[model samples]
Target: MAEKIRLKVKCHACGYVMEGTSKYGKGNYHPEGLDFQFTAVGKLVDKAGNSRVKGEVTILCPNCETRNRFDI
Candidate 1:
């Protein structure tokens, strides 16, 4: 099977780099509308040597070119 990928989505029309729920490095999933499912999260560290997860998110926009990320 192919490996999964993670990336920060770039809104083409608004140029928005979503911050929260986007503090990710890499992850995996099978997106056949939940026929299969899996997810993994990386570590996050702050300037103070602290860490906290921002969690996963799903965002949709109707007026722009926003699309679901593919694990390629």
Candidate 2:
């Protein structure tokens, strides 16, 4: 199996950390303090069968309700 892409984000406001993974053009973040998912727009995978999704995602922090921007 191909290795999953690991995602980690830290909130500058409350210092809360978010973690997730990207595989097959789908992104899934832990729902502990956040609930979110995104699908890659065009191509699902690259020539190597890896996720080809690349973009910016904005999410509100669950702890302080601060808006955080992330690049995936």
Candidate 3:
């Protein structure tokens, strides 16, 4: 069975919830902040426990902190 996960990012300016799909990517990403692009690849394992290039990652965001929040 495949596991489930979720990522929650809050806006610094307005605390707007920035939710995204959490596809399993190894290690910590954006530790230094969201001022750059992040790429990572991990080893894959089959049902029989074999090894392969798992996948890669790309974080796409608006990076617009100024307008991330809205008033009700």
In order, the Cα lDDT scores of the candidates are: 0.41, 0.59, 0.41
Candidate 1 lDDT, tens digit per residue, 37-68? 22444446799996643334354434464643
Flag regions of model 1 displaced more than 4 Å: 1-10, 13-40, 54-57, 68-72
- 30 Cα displacement, candidate 3 (Å): 16
For model 1, the run of ten residues with the poorest summed lDDT: 18-27
Number of the predicted model whose TM-score against the real structure is largest: 2
Candidate 3 per-residue lDDT, tens place, 18-53, comes to: 555432334543333333233344555789996543
Q: After superposition, how far is residue 13 of candidate 3 from its true place, in Å?
A: 1.1
State the number of backbone clashes in model 1.
0
Q: All candidates' TM-scores?
A: 0.29, 0.51, 0.29
Candidate 1, overall lDDT?
A: 0.41
| Ranking of all candidate structures by their lDDT, best first | 2, 3, 1
